[model samples]
Structure formats: C-alpha cells, structure tokens
Target: MANSPQAKKRARQNERRFAVNKARRSRIRTFLRKVEEAIASGDQAAAAAAVTEAQPELMRGVTKGVFHKNTAARKMSRFAARVKAMGS
Candidate 1:
C-alpha cells in the first residue's frame, strides 16, 4: 500500500514504534495491577507504596505519548483516593 519510498519508511517506523509503545503500555498496566492487588488485600501501606511506584510509570506513559496527560492524572487521582479511603 505504501508506494512511495517515504511512505514505506514511515510505515516501517510506525511498526517499530507500535511495538515499543505496546511494551511500555503493558509495563504500565503491570505496575497499576500491583497497586490494585495491594488495595484488594486491604494492605493500605502496601497499596500506598505500590501507587507511589506506579505514579511515575503512569506519568512516563503520558510523557511517552502512550497515554493522554489528563487520562493519567485521572487514573492517579482515583487510585490515590481509593488508597486514602482504605485508611479507615
């Protein structure tokens, strides 16, 4: 489909970027899952720590263009709220 040389090169670049971004997204989800597991177990401290670790990874996803800035913020905000609510 990419008849032009430039288009072919761009397609190749897109494929590589897609693979890298896919891995990054998976890694971010793994970090978030750790937080969710901690929260589910009712370990507030561990949940808080896990969220702290995940915060940067999620933000990194936004910076890397894998996630929107507002999306990442909303996720972090909701997770933090849940972790806070777990206090009592």
Candidate 2:
C-alpha cells in the first residue's frame, strides 16, 4: 500500500513506534498493577510506595507521547485519592 519511498519509510517508522509505545504501555500497566495489588492487600506503606514509583512512570509515558497528559494526571490523581482514602 505504501508505494512511495517516503510512505514506506513512514510505515516502517510507525511500526517501530507502535512496538515501542506498546511496550511502554505494558510497563506502565505493570506499575499500576503493583499499586493495585498493594492497595488490595491493605498495605498502606506499599501502596504509597507503589504510587510514588508509578507516578513518574506514568508521567514519563505522557512525556514520551505514549499517554495523554490529562489521562495520566487523572489516573495518578484517582489512584492517589484511593490510596489516601485507604489510610483514613
């Protein structure tokens, strides 16, 4: 479908970017999962620690164009709220 050389190169770049973004998304999810598990287990310290670790990774995904800024912010906000509520 990419008849032009430029188009072909763009397609290749898209494929590479897609793979990288997918990996980033998966890594972010893993971090989120750690937070979730820590929260579910009712370990306030672990949940807080996981949130600390995940916030940066989520923000990194935003900076790297893997996730939208607001999306990451909302997630972090909600997760932090949940963690906070768990404490009180």
Candidate 3:
C-alpha cells in the first residue's frame, strides 16, 4: 500500500516501466526465436541472416538496459558459434 503521494507516484512509474520493459523483452525474444527456428531448420543461409538481424536487436536491448551486457554478449557469442558450426 502506497500511503505517501511520492510512493504512489513511484508505484505508477514502476508499473509503466514494467510494461515497457516487458514489451521490449518480448520483442527481443521474438528475434531470438527467429534465429532459433532458422537454426533448427538447418538452413545455414537463413540462420546466418537471422543472426545478422538479431545481433543489432540484442545490442539495442543491452544499450536500453533491457538486458545485461554480458548476457547479451554471451547469447550473441553462442549464436555466432552455432551458426559457424552449421557452416562447417
């Protein structure tokens, strides 16, 4: 219960930020899903393209504070490795 006005305002702000962050996270997941599907299909070209498209989105999430830098970096590294392995 937010009794103080300031607390109430903060609660409101948190709710708004939560919504925004949730949407952003969902969008990032969608991009990741595209990459996963491309990879699973065993289409090297599509997987490569998906990774290219997702790279910037993942970094954008990191820049926007939606995801931690290391988390995004690790995901990108793994995805890149998987894509590379698919080629060879």
Candidate 4:
C-alpha cells in the first residue's frame, strides 16, 4: 500500500520500468534462441550470423541494466566459441 504520494509515484514508475525491462529481456531471449536454433540446425554460417546479430543486443541489455556486464560477456564468449567450433 503506497500511502505517500512519492511512494505511489515510485510504484507507478516501477510498473512501467518492469514492463519495459520485460520486453527488452524477451527480445534478447528471442535473439539468443535464434542463435541456438541455427546452431542446432548445423548451419555454421547461419549460426555465425545469428551470433553477430545477438552480440550487440546482449551488450545493449547490459547497458540498459537488463543484464549484468559479466553475464553478457560470458554469454557472448560462449556463443562465439561455439560458433567458431562449428566452423572447424
């Protein structure tokens, strides 16, 4: 219960922020899923392309505070490695 005006405003702001962050997270997950599907399909080129497309999205998530910096970095690193491995 937000009795104070300031608290009520904060609650409203939090709701809006939650919606935005949820959408952003969903978009990031969609990109990551594309990469996973490409990899699973055994298409190295497609997987590489998906990874290229996803890298910036992941970093954007980090910058937007949706994901932690190291979490994004680790995901990018692992995906890149997997893409590279698919080529060899």
Question: TM-score of the candidate numbered 1?
Answer: 0.98
**Which parts of model 1 have CA positions greater than 4 angstroms off?**
none
As a TM-score, model 3 comes out at 0.98
RMSD after CA superposition, every candidate? 0.5, 0.6, 0.5, 0.6
Across 1-88, the per-residue lDDT of candidate 3 in tens digits comes to 9999999999999999999999999999999999999999999999999999999999999998999999999999999999999988
What TM-score goes with each of the models?
Answer: 0.98, 0.97, 0.98, 0.97
Candidate 1 lDDT over 1-88, as tens digits, reads 8999999999999999999999999999999999999999999999999999999999999999999999999999999999999997
Kindly list the per-residue Cα lDDT of model 4 for residues 5-76, writing each as its tens digit: 999999999999999999999999999999999999999999999999999999999999999999999999
Off by over 4 Å in 4: none
Show the colliding residue pairs in model 2.
Answer: none
lDDT per residue as tens, model 2, 1-88? 9999999999999999999999999999999999999999999999999999999999999999999999999999999999999989
Scored by Cα lDDT, where does model 1 land?
0.97
The candidate that wins on lDDT is 1
Off by over 4 Å in 2: none
